[model samples]
Target: MTYNVQIKVMPLKDLLDPQGKAVMSGLQNLGLSGVEDVRVGKHITLRIDAETEEAAKQIADEASKKLLANPVMEFYEIEMIN
Candidate 1:
């Protein structure tokens, strides 16, 4: 069986995201108000061959830890989708 997985990678809350800051600045320049803050992140989708949802989730987690996210400055969340 194959499972669909989604990974969200984002900078740690304690860290500053330069890209997000730039985007916020751009938005303000465009006259967009009421936006207090912005954070930029990456969304990754993967199809994994596994027997069970748990197995697939584990694989995705391993992938995120190994290469998808930088543990030093970033964090990742994984979800199994239909």
Candidate 2:
């Protein structure tokens, strides 16, 4: 079977995201107010062939940990889309 996986990688809460800050600054400059903060992140989609959903999830998790996300500065969440 084939599984569709979505991975979201984001900067850790304790860390400052320069890109996010820059975007927020731009938004404010554009007169977009009331936005307290912004955080930038990456969205990854993967198609994996596996026998079960759990297996696909494991594969996605491993990929996220090994290559997708930087553990020191970022965190990742994986979800099975199908």
Candidate 3:
């Protein structure tokens, strides 16, 4: 089976995000106010070949922990679309 993978990688809640803060400030300057606690993240899309959905998920999870995200400061979610 083949699966389309969608991964969202974001910094852990306790981590500080300077880029997100900057964006929030920019938005306020643009007249969009009252937005607080904005966080920045990354989206990764890929395709994986596997025998089953479970296998695909495992592959994505392993890849995420091993290389895609830093387990200490970041977390990841994997979505498998058939």
Candidate 4:
């Protein structure tokens, strides 16, 4: 079977996100005062061949941990969409 997977990778909450802060500052400078505590993350979508939904999810999780995300500085979430 084929499965669609979605992964979200983000910096750890305790870590400083300079890119996000820079964007937030830019937004504030552009007169968007309501925006606060902005955080930036990556959303990845991919197709995987697996026998079951659970297997697909496991593959996604493994990929996220091993390659897509930096375990020391970032975290990831995986979702399987059939």
Candidate 5:
């Protein structure tokens, strides 16, 4: 079977996100208050042939570790759809 995989890569929680901060401040200036602690992340979409969700997850994990995320300072999440 084929599964659609989506991987989201992002900086660690404690890391600085200047882009997100700028957007947050802009939103506040536009009268959109109560929004805090914004962070930006990347999304990757791909297709994989796997027998089960677990297998798809394993493939996504390897891809994330090797290419999608910077292991030293980044975190990642995976979503799979069949």
Candidate 6:
């Protein structure tokens, strides 16, 4: 069976996101003062062939840990899409 996987990769909370900060600064400069605590992240979607949902999830997790995300500065969450 084929399963759809969604992965979200983001900077660790303790890490500094220069791009996010720059975007926030740009927002403020554009007069959008209500925006605060901006952060940037990546969303990835893929399809995998697996026998079970659990197996699909494991595959997605492994992909995230091994190739999709940077373990040092980023973390990833995987979701199974119906």
lDDT string for model 1 (1-82, tens) is 9999999999999999999999999999999999999999999999999998999999999999999999999999998888
For model 3, the superposed segments whose C-alpha errors exceed 4 Å read none
Cα error of candidate 3 at position 67, Å: 1.2
User: Ten consecutive residues with minimal summed lDDT in candidate 1?
Assistant: 73-82
lDDT: which is higher, 1 or 3? 1
Candidate 5 residue pairs in backbone clash: none
Model 1 lDDT, full chain set = 0.96
Task: Write model 4 residue lDDT over 13-58, tens digit each, in one string.
Answer: 9999998999999998898888769889999997999898888899
Candidate that beats the other on lDDT, 4 or 5, i.e. the better one? 4
User: Would you list the clashing residue pairs of candidate 3?
Assistant: none
lDDT of 5 by residue, 10-61 (tens): 8899889887899899999899988967898898998988898789889999
Model 2 misplacement above 4 A: none
Winner on lDDT between 3 and 5 is 3
Q: For candidate 6, write residues 1-82 as lDDT tens digits.
A: 9999999999999999998999999999898988879889999998999999999999999999889999999999998888
Worst 10 residues of 6 by lDDT: 30-39
Of the candidates numbered 1 and 5, which has the greater lDDT value? 1
Q: List the residue pairs that clash in candidate 2.
A: none
TM-score of 5: 0.82
List TM-score per model, in order. 0.98, 0.97, 0.91, 0.94, 0.82, 0.95
Candidate 5 or 3, higher TM-score = 3
Better of 3 and 4 by TM-score: 4
